[model samples]
Target chain A: MSHDHDHDNELDPFAARVRALETILTQKGLIDPAAIDVIVDTYETKIGPRNGAKVVAKAWVDPDFATWLKRDATAAIGSLGYTGRQGEHMQAVFNAADTHNLVVCTLCSCYPWSVLGLPPVWYKAPPYRSRAVIDPRGVLEEFGLTLPATTKIRVWDSTAELRYLVVPMRPKGTEDWSEERLADLVTRDAMIGTGLARVPA
Target chain B: MNRREANSHAAMLPAGVDAPVFAEPWQATAFAMTVALHDKGLFSWSEWADALSAEVKRPGAASDGHDYYEHWLAALEKLLSAKGVAGKGDVDALAAAWERAAHATPHGKPVLLQNDPSPTEGRGGRIG
Candidate 1:
């Protein structure tokens, strides 16, 4: 349902300053930091991975969207109201029965925040960046996502100009489910290619 | 904005851009502070550029363009220190307070801070 759901408050000075600056700016009245905080909180907690989940769900239910996602991800995703910044350029890779897709930004954390919200801290750390390319299977294993031996893994490295979203395969036994219900099954990591969508419960 | 400042920022930022580049709320604040301060005549764009370039070139800093914001923060700190604004001492005191506050804040709650005594307030109190 999420990525590294811990709320560890051991913030760095940079992280703390923005929080401080929020106070500093609120007094200045050029903009309301509180309102911005509401939006940021939504993206961090409520909306974070949910945007990507909706896109995945739509792709599953709408064949046309899936086709478009495969052919032209930028427009298809943008049409869904999930477009901006680091995600200006995008490619959606589907997870097939035999092939699994993974994403990483080795140079820096170029995540689709417009859809995925802020990336987990681990994603930006040195270990994940180096190990993701060196041993993706091991990385997946650490995240507790173990793909079968027959499945092939494809890793996409996100760049400043181009980013990627992973579309996990639809779970079984949910053929009659509503789109909203299906979206609830998509976790942030699923779209990050670190985990699979939830199995029907 | 000064002509030089405007020219530099335009060149640095992408063109025809409709992007939400800030990953977190704080990032947006940090970014806005840069622009707002620049417009307020606190520092010239050229000065900012020099500080940022020096920061990027500083040993042990990541020179890649991905961490541009980190460099942005560094430049802000450098400017703050040199101008006798909120130097490292003031920022550090405030930063430590935030660490404690953030640590105590519950999960799913907004991290808020209260003004506390650490570095004495007012310009030049901590800086000078």
Candidate 2:
């Protein structure tokens, strides 16, 4: 005789509830399910982290844009067509020789979705959310990104509707590099202040 | 939450605000369901307030965002089921079907529910 446990009975209750909700909504003709998928795909791929990278690259090469970004990030980011919903209010924090910037939403997971798209899991997880504020230097170290002891770390807690985008310091020897080339060095973590921008090799 | 607080929760938003940030497709599906239900006037704010609060208390844990949304979905379902918008039994059954669909489908592909409920029967089924 063989006894077996069926996995179908083990669907995570959370997922099950979501699926059930979807079924009920469709049956009531509340929405077209197919359309939601298309929208999800669009945000995940077409309008994602690349938008932030472009902004970072532009700031690295254009001194005027950097000044504009510092003065009025909302308009500067909007001028680039990256303004919407979660990113209606934008603040650009520049990393300097003496300071580094980090962002977190202590209340809820508020991010600049229009520019960075969906946040990575770690960003919303409890450990990163709490530790990023209490012990940012330690959290950065865990990500293998240790900053100099003298560099003051500024943690920005995104609340209500305000969101921030980090402008990483430009790597050395890239004075003549194009904005497009400079953009390649900026990573999501770098913008989030967990890691540093890559140096051109 | 009171009337004012209930209205402010992100889950109660009409629809289409931020980029779709789903830990999984089901999460997106959940959000769409709530938005759709709101558009249809299926439930009331007081009902939403009670259900959501019951499912998720507060943001005690920092990493509880995903779980918080999951509870939000659960609250939505509870409200719909209680209001006879849908039957609880049928919902459970469909959820089970999705689980079977997931088991039958290969990794990296979408797990679509099959007309045949027991799609995982026989043919190795990855049995131990």
Native contact fraction, candidates in order: 0.20, 0.29
Alpha carbon lDDT of each predicted model: 0.67, 0.68
Clashing pairs in 1: A85-B19, A85-B20
**DockQ of predicted candidate 1:** 0.12
The stretch of ten residues in a row with the least summed lDDT in candidate 2 chain B is: B8-17
- The residue pairs found clashing in candidate 2 are A125-B63, A126-B62, A126-B63
Q: What i-RMS does every model get?
A: 12.5, 11.8
- In terms of lDDT, model 2 sits at 0.68
DockQ of every candidate structure: 0.12, 0.16
RMSD of each: 13.0, 11.5
Regions of candidate 1 where Cα sits further than 4 Å from its true position: A1-39, B1-128
- In model 2, what lDDT does residue B38 have? 54
Question: Residue A72: error of model 1 in Å?
Answer: 1.9
Write down the TM-score of every candidate: 0.60, 0.68
